[model samples]
Target chain A: MEIASFLIVFFMVRYIRTSLQTAVRFPEWERILVIVQYAASGLLAADVFLDSSITKWLWHLLLLGMVGAAYLLKDFRPVRNVWLAVGPYILVSLFKDIAKLIDSDFYESISTVVEIAEIFTLVWLIATWVSTQRQQKALEKERLKRLQEEEQSRIIAGQNVMLEQLVAERTAELTRQKEELEQTLTELKATQDQLIQREKMASLGELTAGIAHEIQNPLNFVNNFSEVSVELIEELKEERRREDRDIELEEELLTDLTQNLQKITHHGKRADSIVKGMLQHSRTSTPQREPTDLNNLADEYLRLAYHGLRASDKSFNATLIMDFDEHLGKVSVVPQDMGRVLLNLFTNAFYATEQKRKTGLAGYQPTVQVSTKRLSDEQIEIRVRDNGCGIPKTVLTKIYQPFFTTKPTGQGTGLGLSLSYDIVTKGHGGELTVETEEGEFTEFIIQLPT
Target chain B: MKVLVVDDETDVQILFEQRFRREIRAGELIFAFAHSGEKALAYLNEHPSEYVLILSDINMPGMSGLELLRLIKTTYPAPPPVVMMITAYGDSESHDQAMQLGADAFLTKPLDFNNLKEKLKSAL
Candidate 1:
């Protein structure tokens, strides 16, 4: 029974040594525990195999050495961890040996229970350490993921801020550019107006030459007529002198000659008046800018303009309406310039009516209404409204542009309205604007300072 | 030939008379006068083709010289008497139109009688 008990203890130590060796090499203490456990198992197994008294005693010494090693290693040293792995095997071996020395079955059972309890404790410690390592690795992975997410969010926010700033900066730049573009457009318009004025002056020079020739043609008539009168006077004087004896006959002849001379003078003076009106129409450059009643100016030009239209197209008859504001005070403007403006307006009105008549517009009774009003303390407004064929909406924008005209090539110079616009806006420091619809009516508004 | 002289200014008549005194004595021309466009047209209508040439102003109150020229060119196409367009400002637009409308010659004033004579000789 003693030998059997020794063999069982030897086999248990051998199995514990194998279990320790199979455990992964972890902490340095655990490696040392595994090595000591291996040596202890070998010594116990040899004692059981030899079955000699000296071997038994040596096993007893070996067990004593193991217990001493356990106490020395137990002071929290690396060997203490090593012993913990081999501790169960060494204890089992010592308990069996002591049980053999005592030769008692009851003590052997208690030693066996203590050895099993120690082995179970070693396995529980190893499992606790492995699970702790796995949990630490998992925690590190979670921290890394959280840090990456924070960094990604920061990067996205930074990009959005930069984009917002970029858009704001671009909008500011665009606003400045738009303002500059508008300024440039206004400057271009002013320059264009000056150019038109220069061109109109050049055309006026041309008209001056035309008027000079026109003046000379009538002058030629006056010369020829007076010369004929002189010849007739000489002939009458000679007849009176040659037939001095026939007094009654000479007197009758003299009376007839005097009557013919008076007739000639009458027709000559009538011709002269017509030429003078033409001269006045053409020579209008020397403007007299003064505080003049625009209403009176409109009325005067309206008559001349209507006469001109009647002369040009004898068949056309259009009504001229004057709605001059009597209460409106005088405006500081060139009266002659304003007169020309009115003339141009009336002429355009008459021409439109003529066109409408030719086109067979039903009941197209042309009406031109000249109206005025005081808009404010500093400004007065004059409106020239025409019920003749209205300006087409598409062409309204180009009406004030120089050299833009609706009339045929020979009929109109296309500078009339452009000149009027310049005179009103630049010369008088006023405003000229128009309102019109395609088949309705056209109205030109001129505003000048009071 | 009985020629009509139409003019508004008395000074222009005096100058013309002083210039053409020698011609009158030689019976080279006869003259009657009307200054305005209406008078000139009336005279021309009364004595159509009687005058050798019509010296017409472009701008006149009763009727423009252009209107008179158009009337003359259209009414009397075959035996149309010569017309010499004269202006101080000889604009290309007016000059070209006048020539196209069968004006014999275009003359710009102050009147050069020497050029006038040459143009008249050519037309006659």
Candidate 2:
């Protein structure tokens, strides 16, 4: 019984410590039961050495009180287990006492039955407590697993949002770079066109100069021979007058000869003018200002440029619209330079309209219009407008810059417009401006102060 | 008086003959012709004393008229034929160059025959 008491005390103390460590509330009734059980155990231990029946009886009474206290605290897990374990033992003790009092022969069998019942109850209590503890542990493990999965999913969701943001930012950057690349490509194309135009103009100028030089010798021969023929005819006429034979026939022959000579003079002068024009076109000359008729100058250059284009491309044709202000009268300008300016503008106008015609667009009629208006007594305005493939807005600002041309290689010397601009603005103290809409029409306006 | 006309164009011979027909028939003036500057130089070498005047075209395929004038002024015998340089290019630069190279007269073409006749008579 002493050893049993020690073992029970040890188990009870360990259980209380475990409950306290686990932060489980210790009930008031349970505390009292524990103190009573300790006192009972002490009493029982003293009786074992002293051999005192009173001490034993006191221990039995304390044990009965402990059982009653356990019953009152039965809602607590540890107390319920203790009450189940101790109740059977206490009942058995009471039964033993009754049997002794009755003086029955069944006392020993009853005690054996009581002992079996106690052992069974103790086993059941231990099993119930252990099962409850294992169930609680499993629930805690499940909750922790669920919390961890939630935390991992939250992290993954944050990463997904960051990845999407990065993708959007990269896409925006790519679009910006593509725009920049396109802008650069356009500029490069314009520069390449300018360079090709410059090369073509340089070669054409050289070729035209050579042709002018070669033509001069023959032109001189024609003019000189015609003049000498007239003189020889005059000498022959003088001799015939002195001889006085076949006078009527001689006069008829002389009249025929003089008419033929006049024809030769007229054609020779025309050839001279053409050769001079070619030479002037090939060479850059100092500006010489004189009173020039704006109407005649515009008319002359418009026809000249049209003929020049026709000489190059036989299939090209356009209806020229000329609206000259006859009242504009004479303006003080360098006629040669102004003529060049008009020629360039007219040529560009014709070229634009011709290009539009080549696209095979039905009902497209190429037309270039040249108009002059006297804005005031001091200012004259000249406009060359075309219903053609207009200048694109992107390239409009660069047209006056040297070497900027829309024409293909070998067709233009981008210097035409640039030189014209220089002649009008810098050389003549005038203004040159342009108006255009892409794919619709283009107009160049020159305003000169008379 | 004998005059030498040096030119590449063969038609120039006809023009001169027609213009001065009376003078040639009256034995007042004689004319000779050479096709190029080199040929003119060869002619001068052969008949150094026969010619009184040299009218040479400035531009020629070989041995330009200017170079021929330089040779005639420096290497020819004393009293070399009066050298005249003519060109279709009437630019001041050619005129200046011809005068600098000892040409007696620099003429531009479509030659004014009346003025040329006066100049030729005055020189004679």
Candidate 3:
């Protein structure tokens, strides 16, 4: 039992030291308590050899002091309970010592009861110490979990920063691409406008030759008729001043003067219309579409083209047949561009007939016919047909190709049909098609969607 | 004496009739008009030797005044009518070409009618 008590005191020393390390602040005092417990254990071992009453008394008193020292460590409930387990044992031993001195018989019975009580208190102290250890372990696990959670949050913060940077870079690149695309579209539109302008200027060059020639006649008539009218006025004045005024001759002179003035007025109007036509032909084209009367447009251009050809080549004559749909109301088109297309087609038709005329085909009257028709509610078609030297089958397919011309050098730019094709097909979303026979006739048709 | 005026402008006929009214009315000068070189040639075909002098415009639709001059001077029968080339072009090029084509005179428009009358009188 004493050995068992010594082993329990040894375990108590270790358990109290660990448990008290957390609860107690005084290290030197805890050291002293540990020494005291060790001394108590030694004394319990000494009791097996020592037979003297004084020695027995000394061992028990030292054991009693060790338990009393543990009471100072009240932070541990088990240490506090150690006093309960050992108290009566110490008292019973002290009484037994006194009984030995006085020679009494009651000591054995009382010691047994105190010893059992001491064992019960020891069991309760050990249970409390074990439970305290489990509590400390749970606290250690909670601290470790908190450390791992902080590390994960730190890593997440770093990833979020990188993700935001990536998004910013991608957004900047997309913005750059959008800006580049807008710039390219602007450049492309500018280039398209330039090409159309160039083609317009080229056709204007063709019209200039005829204009110079045609303008001469009206101007000549205006001058000559007015000059002759001035002479008639001088004659009428002479007749009025005569002694016997010739009324019949004076009236005839006045009538001739009136006729000459009318001719002057007629020629002046002709000049005005020619200048207006030239202005319209040379007008810069706007890219936007607007409402336009197709019949009026065709008629105006056909006259210009014919007069132009007449002025340049006096022998070039054609029977112009216009079959315009009177009910063909205003259609949406880029007026300048569409006008250019019509002029190009008219100039070509006239050229074709003139070529056949030059061949001196007997009884061949050069004829060019332009007709417009409304095919449906959504579509309109214009056909320019010529009974002249038609497109040879070999060169027919290549007519729309840029820089291709069957006409003599310095006469055709070869851009006319190609540009006209582009204006009809791409600009207006229409189709340009040609029907031809080698030496019979050629007809160009323009189909448009309303 | 009869003079034929060959030009593409029909107005030339009216102008000549009015401008030379005194001479025409007196029958001292007779004027005939043809609107084109082709018509002038046709007129000549009908009356080959009646016309004493011809006044022609250089630029006409069929058979230019220069070509007509060439035909009249070379192809037509003897006693050709006097051919004067009147044109809007005063350029030395057409003048030289007309002269080469045997044009009796080259005149520029707007015609100096007074100068034309003097030249016409001299040619006749």
Question: TM-scores of the models, in the given order?
Answer: 0.40, 0.41, 0.57
Q: What fraction of native interface contacts is shared by candidate 3? A: 0.40
Query: Docking quality tier of candidate 3?
Result: acceptable
For lDDT, candidate 2 versus 3, the one ahead is 3
Model 1 bad stretches (over 4 Å): A1-127, A146-330, A333-379, A384-390, A395-431, A437-442, B1-58, B61-124
Q: Rate the local accuracy (lDDT) of all candidates.
A: 0.63, 0.72, 0.79
Per lDDT, the best of the predicted structures is 3
Q: Report lDDT (Cα) of residue A390, candidate 2.
A: 94
Could you say which candidate leads in TM-score?
A: 3
RMSD of 3: 10.8
Model 2 agreement with the true structure over A1-450: per-residue lDDT tens digits: 334334444454455445443234556545654665577567766876887656645545665554554456444345445655455555655565667557657766576776676566556545754775586579668878888988888998999999899999999999999999999999988975565345435533433533344445456656666766677677666767785666675665466456546646655665565566555554444656889888877875676666555434544667678898878989999876787788788878888988888888897768889999999988999999999999987898899887677878766677888878988999889999999987789999999998
Score chain B of each candidate by TM-score.
0.84, 0.97, 0.95
Rate residue A205 of model 1 by lDDT: 43
RMSD of each candidate relative to the true structure:
13.2, 17.8, 10.8
